[model samples]
Target: MEVWLNYVFGLRPRNFWGLVCIPLFPLLHGSYQHLTGNTQAFLLLGWFILMQGIHLFYVVTIATALISGVGAWLFGPPNSVGVGASGVIYGYLGFILMYGIVSGSWIALLLTLIIAVRDAWRITGNKYNESQLLPVERSPRMGWTAHLFGFIGGVLIALALSDMRLN
Candidate 1:
């Protein structure tokens, strides 16, 4: 059942049918490890976003998914089927970090710092042995493309909303 869902819902780059998966990819995971790996970060970051408000939470989530999904679809490795919530996780990371910077919120900044310190190893660790000489030369299984795009989307959304008063 897991494999079947992943097969049907995973993001397929450059395929018209894959477009539908933009909203669905984050809901699917390839394995137990994959799901667990994303769950912690997703919850942590999502909680911070939710602190701002429920409406903003939905906005950040939906926008980040769209931007990250489209970006992965455009630049992801050919024929790769991407799955997992890492993109949204990364999106949350980006949003919180950028929001802290842009909004001058000490709480946001402190939360960002806490997350950075706690996850520093994961953020800096090299998952691939190769130097990744090119942006596209990533492990097809890693969803680095989704991470990158999702981070960008999060930052963009944060910037877009920076002017608003946030809690």
Candidate 2:
């Protein structure tokens, strides 16, 4: 089931058939660990966005998934399949941080600060040590491209939404 789902839904870079995965990849995971890790962050960040507004939460999620997925599909390492919600989690983190700054919400700002302090390593792209890996062993590669694009997308979305409010 896992293999089948990944084959069908995982983002594959530069593959014409993989375009559908843009909106679906965030819903798939490579393993239990992947799913669990994403679940915690997704729920927490999603809750923060939800606290602002349910509509905003949905909009951010959809936009982030599309932007991040397209980024991964375009720039992911050749022959690699990207599967997991880490990209979306990163998107949520970006959205919360930027939204807080743009909206000047004290609660959002406080929460962002807490998350930043706690997940600084992750946000800064130092969460893994590739040098420690055995050359013979296979490990999932971090989707840094997705994370980068997702964060950018989140910030852009936050700015757009804030502008809409101002007008």
Please tell me which predicted candidate would have the highest lDDT against the true structure.
1
- Per-residue alpha-carbon lDDT of candidate 1 for residues 1-167, written as tens digits (9 for 90 to 100): 98988888899999987888889998998878778877877787898889889999999998888888998899887888888877787788788878888888787778778877775544444563321212544454565777778888999999999996566
Worst 10 residues of 2 by lDDT: 129-138
**1-167 per-residue lDDT for model 2 (tens digits):** 99799988788889977777777788888779778878988888898788777888899999988888888788777887788777777788788778778877677677778988876766544426221111222235655777777888888889888743211
The residue-level lDDT of candidate 1 at 71 comes to: 88
Clashing pairs in 2: none
Model 1 spans > 4 angstroms off: 127-140
TM accuracy, model 1: 0.88
> In candidate 2, how many Å is residue 110 off?
1.6
Clashes counted in candidate 2 amount to 0
Total backbone collisions for each predicted model: 0, 0
